[model samples]
Target: MELFVFVCAAIMVLVGALGVVLRSNPVHAALSMILTLFGVAVLFVAREANFLAAVQVIVYAGAIVVLFLFVIMLLGVDRAEDLRTEPLGNVQRPLALVLGIGMFALLTTAVVRSRDSLRFKGDGVKTATLEDADGNIRQIARSIFGDYVVAFELTSVLLIVAVVGTVVLARRRKSERTAS
Candidate 1:
């Protein structure tokens, strides 16, 4: 069951990546990236990283993607002209292709090596230390407040800034229209 879910999530992520790369419209690309982030979150949940999964969905899928979409909408990018400009042409094309191929080969080698070396005992997965609900909750609380407090605070501040900036931009646009 877990394997099946993982496979589906992987497929979704791959399709989303392709869509992000191939789509002509910036909005579509941003949406695709959101889908990719959602798949990653699902994968994290399947792996029993519940807190991480929630953070992935909340931070990346919800906040970051919405910000990206808002920026795309605010810019009012011309779809036709944006599509016409081949940004990856000329000098960057061959370099990008070579780098991509090299990265793929390196990743493939690493995966193969890891699979061959890594061994699983019993049911093939280690039992998590915080198995009980209360234990898990405590573990999560400690990790967040103890180790990641600064990061958590920073994320909240960042979100606040994003919200304020969006409102300011919208108000400025409305004031400009009224003046005109």
Candidate 2:
């Protein structure tokens, strides 16, 4: 049944999310991210958003996660971090955890308030679907290019800058080791 499938996908998403946070190894975390993305794609498919689901799998699980793995390998900083060390003194991790939980609670409350719209996918309920003749993805592209073009381009530029910075840092570290 659809309920069963949705439950399974939700469980996989939670497990993958926990793995991403709980795993010490960066590679394992990246792999878990792939799992989380794939699970999200499944949820999209269950919602009848086929194009969105495809893009989620192809772009996020495929390209972005591979980029993450590439950066991890290139930086050669994939070693396990010492979790016991509070490098930021005593106030960082606890504060972060508190903020994270508060944000999660807020988002969960928002989603629960909008639960009616979400019931369409699970119960075969008739609700307003976004797609028509032009398609849901076309609407997405229009918004991305028409309304948020500047932000979109800026995001791409930011990603390129991050990649360049990572490469430069890796090279600098290598040269430092060689000189030493």
Model 2, range 11-107, lDDT digits (tens) per residue? 8899999989888889999888888888899998788677788888989977899989988999997987765763767888789899999999999
Regions of model 2 farther than 4 Å from truth: 86-88, 114-180
Cα error, residue 106 of model 1, in Å, equals: 1.2
Best by lDDT: 2
**Residue 163 miss distance in model 1 (angstroms):** 9.5
In candidate 1, position 125 carries an lDDT of 30
* Tens-digit lDDT track of model 1 for 93-170: 779889999999999999988996776654333224645644545667777898899988998999899889979776
Computed on alpha carbons, the lDDT of every model, listed in order, comes to 0.80, 0.82
**Residue 95 lDDT (model 1):** 91
Q: Which stretches of candidate 1 lie over 4 Å from their true place?
A: 78-84, 116-131, 134-137, 147-180
Clashing pairs in 2: none
Clashes of 2: 0
> What TM-score goes with each of the models?
0.69, 0.66
Candidate with the greatest TM-score versus the true structure: 1
